[model samples]
Target: MESDSHDALDRRLVHALQLAPRAAFSRLAAVLGVSDQTVARRYGRLRGAGAIRVLGLSDPERLGEVRWQLRVRCSPDSAGAVATALARREDTVWVSLNSGGTEIACSTRTPPDRSDHSLLLQHLPRTPSVLGVSAHCVLHTFFGGAQSLAVKSGALSAGQVAELAAAGPRVAEPDGPVPELDAADRRLLAVLAVDGRAPLAELAAACGKSESTVRRRLEELAASGVLYYDLDVDWRIFGLRTHTWLWLNVVPSELAAAGAALAGHPEVAYACATTGPSNLHAVVITRSVRELYAYLTTRVAALPGVQHLETAPTIRIVKGPGPLPLSSPRDI
Candidate 1:
C-alpha cells in the first residue's frame, strides 16, 4: 500500500534523526542512501504532521533539577479538563491520559521555588473531581536521555553513528553542577528550545550576536552539558504499537539494584526510583500486546526485588517532551 511505503520511509528518517539530532541533510542523505532533496522533503512532511520534533533541551541533571512523576485519578467527566490544565504548567514536561482515560500521569521538573510538592499536596486534591494524587520524585534515572525511546527501531550502525558524531557538537553531561548561563546564553537557548536545527544566521539574529560567536557559545554549552537534544517521534509510526508505564513496589533495600536492572532492558525507555507506593516506574515500548506479554512474563516477573507491579496503557499523549500540544477546535 502507498501508505505503508510512506510510513516506512518516515520511520527510517526518524531513526536517522535520533542518531544525529542536528545532522545536515547531506549527511543524512548519504547515510540513508537517498538524495538530499528527498531527505529534506520527508523531514518537512513529518514536521508538518506533528509526528516528530527536534528540541534542544537543557539537561535537568546538569542543571541540578529533580524530576517528579505525578499520577492523578479523576472522575471520568473531569479527567480531560484536569489533564489539560496540568499540561499548561511550565514545570510539567510530559502529560498523558492513561489507564482507560480515568487517570492522568505526567513528569514535572522542580522549579526554582521548589514548589513541586504543592501540586500534589495542595492543588489537585482541592479540585472537585480529583479522587487521588501521588507524587514520586525521580531519585535516579537509569536509561533516560538522548537514547531513551530512540531504541524502538534499533540504533544506527556503529560506523554510521561514529560518522555523525564526528561531524557535529559533542555532548558531555556534567556530574557536578555547571555554572548558570549568562543573559546572552539564555537568549540563545530560548530560541533553540523552539527549533534545535535552526540556522546559524537565524540563531545569531535572535541572540544579537555574530555567527562565529553563537557557534562557539553553543559548543561551549553543549560541552559543559548545559544543553542536549531530544529527538521526538510518534513510536506508533515505527511499528511500536504498545506503550505502557510500569509501577513497581520493590523492597527498600533492593530499590537501587531493581532500578538498575530494569534500566538494562532494551524495551524500557526509562526507569527511575520514585517516592510513593510504587517506588519504581518505567516507560516501555513494544511491538504488540503479545510482545508486551512476553516481556512481562519472562523478563519482568523474574526481577529480584519486584514484589508487586501495575501496568497502565498510555491512551493519549496530550503533551510531549518539546512543547505543550495546543488545543484545536476539534478538541472542543
Candidate 2:
C-alpha cells in the first residue's frame, strides 16, 4: 500500500490513536467528524490488515531494567535463521535483518541484575553461524516508544490534536519515582503487550482481578509513565520505502543537542544515546534512496558535532512492536 491508496480518514484515525491509544471510539468519532461505528470499523480494518497495531509497552529504565541494541553479523546462509531465533525470544522487543541480510539488528531488554547472563553474553555466542556481535547499552532515549512518527503526518489540525491531548492520560514527570509492577501487574502487562486495546474484561481475566480493580491499576500505570502505548505500522503504506540506521559519533559536549535535533526530524523514527564508539543512534525512514541522500547531505550534515556517521540499511523486519507468537526455535 502507498500513501495515495489511503484516504484522509485513515491518516486522521492513525494520528488520533497515536495521541490517545485507548481513547473511546465515540471520542475519536467526534474529533474526526465521523460516526462511532465508522471510527471503530476503520480501526478494525487497518489492524486486521496488519498495517498497524497498538501495543502497551513498558519503559525498561523506569522499571529498573536495561535495554541493549545488538548488531549480530552472521554467515550469509544463516542470517535469516539466527534473526528468526532472536525474534522468538521473549526478551527481544524487535529484530530485523540489515545490511542486505548479513547482519541482524535487535533491541532487547534484561533485568539490571542479570546483565552478565543476558542472551547477548550467553546464547548468541554459542551460535556456530554467528561471526561477530556488538552490543550497545542504551543510555537514554531521546525519542521513541510512545513518540510516533504519525505525529508528523499533519493529518489532524492543531485544534483537534489539542482536544485529544486534553482527554488523554497524563504523563508523569520523568524524574518522578518509578512505580513497581507486582505479579498481577506483570500478568496484566503480558496480555497488553500483544494488544493495547484489549477489552477491560480480558485484562481482568488475565490478571485474575475484577474489572474495577484492573481498571484502577491500569490507570495508575499509565499515569506513572511505567506503561505507555505505541503503534507499529508498515512505513511503506505512508510512502516511506527506505529504512536506515544512523550510527553517529558526536563530541560528548554536543551529544544531547544532536540527539534532540535528530528526534525532531520527520525522517527519524527512533533516536537515542548509547554506550559505544558511536554514542548516538537513530533509525530513519525516507520515501526513496534519493530522498535519503538528500537527508544525509543536508539535515544530517548540519548536526551539532558529528564526527563520523555510518549508515546501515534494513533489508527486512523479522519482528515488530507487538509480541511474536510463542514457538520453538528452528534448527540452523
Candidate 3:
C-alpha cells in the first residue's frame, strides 16, 4: 500500500515537472497539496536514484538544424561498443541497442550550414563490424522533446494542470524568426543540458556572466523557442516494461493526419514524419507485450492510412535524453 502511494505521488510530481520543468518548489507544492519541503525532498531523492532527470535541450528545428535518425547494424560484439561511441558524441541525442542487440538506433543533429551527411559518409562504413547503416532525415515532429508521455499519465487533475501551466514560462510563437546562439549562450546551454534546474548563480558562473544577465538570457532563449526542458524518467518505475519503436508507411496525402493521430495516442512517447521508406515514426511504451499487441490491433489499426508497420523492440538503452559523460573516440 505504501509503495503504491509513493508511486502515485511520484507520478504526480513527474507530471507536474513535465508541465513546468523549472517551476519553483513552492509552486509545485501548492498545486500538489504537499509541503514545499516534501516536493524538494522527493525531487532530490528521485534525481539521486538516477530514476529521473530534467534536461534543457535545444530544438534543432528552431535552430535551423537538421536531425537524423540512424539505424546501424553491427555484429553482436561490436554493437555495444559502437553504440557507446556514438552516445559519447555531443551530436547524438539518444542511443539504443535493439533487435536482440545486433542493431543500434540513435539520433543526431547537425547545423544547417554544414553538410549533414558528413558523419554518415566519413564513419561507420570504415568499421569492419558494421553490417549496414540507414539514415533517415527528420522532416517534422508531431510529438516529442518537451511533450512527454507523463503528460498522458492523468496523475494530476485538469485544474491542477491548468494552474501549473498558467505559471509556467511562455514559449515564443512557432513562426517567429529563428534566434542564433552566441558563444555565451552555448556555454549557458551546455550547463543546462546536464541539469535543467541548475541554480541561476551556477549558470551565470558557467557562462561567465552575472546572475541577472544569465536569467535574462535564459528567458530570452526559452521565449524564442530555441531552448526547452524535457523530462527523462525510468518507465520501469511506473511499471511500463515495454518500449518499442514503430515505423509506419502512410499515404503521403494522409501523412499529416496519421502523424497527428499518433501524437495523441497515450502509448506514444515520440512521433514524427521523416524522409524515408517509412514516413511516420513513433516510440511507444506499454506495460507488457500483451498490451502492445492490443494497442497495435486496436488504436494503431484505426489510424487513417498506415500501409505498413515495423516494430523494433528496444533490447537496451545505451543512453537517454541528456548528454553522456564520456568523450567521443577518434575511432570506433
Better of 1 and 2 by lDDT: 2
- Per lDDT, what order, best first? 2, 3, 1
Error (Å) of candidate 1 at residue 32 is: 1.8
Residue pairs with backbone overlap in model 2: none
Candidates' C-alpha lDDT: 0.78, 0.87, 0.86
Compared with the true structure, the alpha-carbon lDDT of candidate 3 equals 0.86
lDDT of 2: 0.87
Could you give candidate 3's per-residue lDDT for residues 1-332 as a string of tens digits? 11233578888999999888889999999999999999999999888766688989888889888899988999988998999888888888768888788998889889888884676887888889999998899999999977899899898999999998887767667887667789989999999999999999899989899999988888888888898899878776567878888999999999999999999999999999999999999999999899999999999999998899999988777788788734232110
TM-score of each: 0.91, 0.95, 0.95
Task: List pairs with backbone clashes in candidate 3.
Answer: none
**Candidate 3, 171: how far from true, in Å?**
2.5
Give lDDT tens digits, candidate 1, residues 263-324. Answer: 88878987888888899899988888899999999889988788899999887777777657
Model 2 poorest ten-residue lDDT run: 323-332
lDDT tens string, model 2, 168-204? 7677567877777789999999888988988999999
Question: What are the runs in model 1 whose C-alpha is more than 4 Å off?
Answer: 1-8, 115-117, 326-332
